[model samples]
Target: MIEVKNTGKPDERRDFPRGHLDVLDLTGLNFGVATFDPGWRWSESLRELAGTDSCQTHHNGYVLQGHLRIRMDDGEEADVGPGDVFVVPPGHDAWVVGDEQVMVFDFAGGMAEYAKAKG
Candidate 1:
């Protein structure tokens, strides 16, 4: 089977303090486009909503625009920008690094659960 979706019209959209995520649900995958405004930080914006100290969702993503800095629980870090393909494991924090808004496309499955209020 084949499936197609335009992220501009997403199946679901989740908004946080300084960012938002648009998601498309396909046959066996959940794809997402996340936009983070400058000053958006996972620890500051999403920790309370997620009920976790650090992001626990794994991400397989491609940076589409602007810059993002990610730091792992163990202190390893990296900056991703346009055209960069990245895989971020669970237990990490991320923030927008510049004045421009950061856009990223995520192919990993866990984004569906990102920033959801804890039950």
Candidate 2:
């Protein structure tokens, strides 16, 4: 099967304090567009909703605008900017790095679970 979706017209949308995620569901895959306003931090903005100390979602994504910083549970860290492709494993925290809003296109699955209140 085949499908096409404009992230702007996402199948699901989630809003948080300084960020939002738009998700598209396709056959056997899920795609997402995440936008983080400056000062947005995963730990501060999403931890309570996710019920975790840090993010547990695996992300295979491309940085589309501005910059983002990711720090792993092991303390390893990296900064990604526009035109960069990155893979972030579970167990990490991320934040916007500059005044500009950060936008990322996530191709990995499981984003439907990201930042959702745990049951």
Best by lDDT: 1
lDDT of 2 by residue, 9-119 (tens): 999899999999998889888888999999999999999998889898999999999999999999999999999999999999999997999999998897878866677
The per-prediction CA RMSD against the true structure, in angstroms, equals 0.8, 0.8
Runs with alpha carbons beyond 4 Å of true place in candidate 1: none
- Give the true-structure RMSD of model 1: 0.8
What lDDT score goes with residue 72 in model 2? Answer: 100
The lowest-lDDT stretch of 10 consecutive residues in candidate 1 is 110-119
lDDT of each: 0.92, 0.91
Clashes of each: 0, 0
* Candidate 2 residue pairs in clash (backbone atoms < 3 Å): none
Q: Model 2: which ten-residue window has the lowest total lDDT? A: 110-119
